[model samples]
Target: MSAHAMKMLNTLLPALVAVFSASTFAGEAQIELKEGAGRDTVMANCAMCHSIDYIQMNSLFMKRTDWQATVDKMVNVMGAPISQDDISVILDYLTTYYGVE
Candidate 1:
């Protein structure tokens, strides 16, 4: 190839690769929760803002009270658009599966 063509290829190829790879790294599949009571409720409500992975990860460190606080924050501070009724169901599921034993 010509010198000018080689120069353009070197510059543009890396830029194109980076633009595509960035999107791949940024987006990820949501982790599916195990089936149990209120699993559907959690999938519908909490996943609206963050991934199920967030709950799974925090479950390692948090207890029922921490999950309660997190859920409260999502609703009260972050405006999660969840209902009080659903809150109870979601809390139950989180505490049961993800909550500290």
Candidate 2:
């Protein structure tokens, strides 16, 4: 209605959008997958078969070979259909970030 009101609405609108955007991406930030694996890769390849918690909870625990085996199992036993490269990426992330001693 008023010019001042319109200006305030414009300013507040952007702030509101920013707040929502930050909140939306906040869930993304919580993801701790390996650097190369990233959120999209994990979601595309892993989320269909398992929960993100399954990945997060194992972080910093499984050994490198164990992680490789797990990925292999997902492909061979669980029928995840992931490519060898993707498997490698996922294993690399898990081992580097969460591998056990």
Candidate 3:
């Protein structure tokens, strides 16, 4: 190859490797949520906007009211298309499985 071609390959190769490596790592970093009655609904709805890992991260301190407020914010403020029925199930699951006192 020409020297110019070699130099371009050297410049782009690291960037290409980094991009692929990051994507591979991200794909493998999924959070497996605890199984529950509303697990499927929460997975389907919540993951539409943010990582489901947020639930696990906050479970240590979140209460029923906190989950309710968060869901309200998601619906009223963020325009998440969660049906009323799904909201009830999701709240129940979150509060029962993840809530604190």
Model 1 residue 4 lDDT score: 100
For candidate 1, write residues 1-101 as lDDT tens digits. Answer: 99999999999999999998787546545366879999999989977777677877788888889999998999889999999999999889989998886
Worst 10 residues of 3 by lDDT: 24-33
The candidates, ranked best first by TM-score, are: 3, 1, 2
Question: What stretches of model 3 exceed 4 Å from their correct place?
Answer: 1-28
The CA root-mean-square deviation of candidate 2, after full C-alpha superposition on the true structure, stands at 9.4
Better of 1 and 3 by lDDT: 3
Would you give me the overall lDDT of model 2? 0.75
TM-score of 1: 0.71
Per-model TM-score, in order, reads 0.71, 0.58, 0.73
Give the candidate number with the greatest TM-score.
3
Query: Model 3, range 1-101, lDDT digits (tens) per residue?
Result: 99999999999999999999898659648778789799999989998888777888899999999999999999999999999999999999999999998
The CA lDDT of each predicted structure is 0.86, 0.75, 0.92
Please provide, for model 2 over 1-101, each residue's C-alpha lDDT reduced to its tens digit, 9 standing for 90 to 100.
99999999999999999998888668756765555544566668888876676777876567988778888888899889898777776766677666777
Q: Estimate the lDDT of model 1.
A: 0.86
Off by over 4 Å in 1: 1-30
Question: Of the candidates numbered 1 and 2, which has the greater lDDT value?
Answer: 1
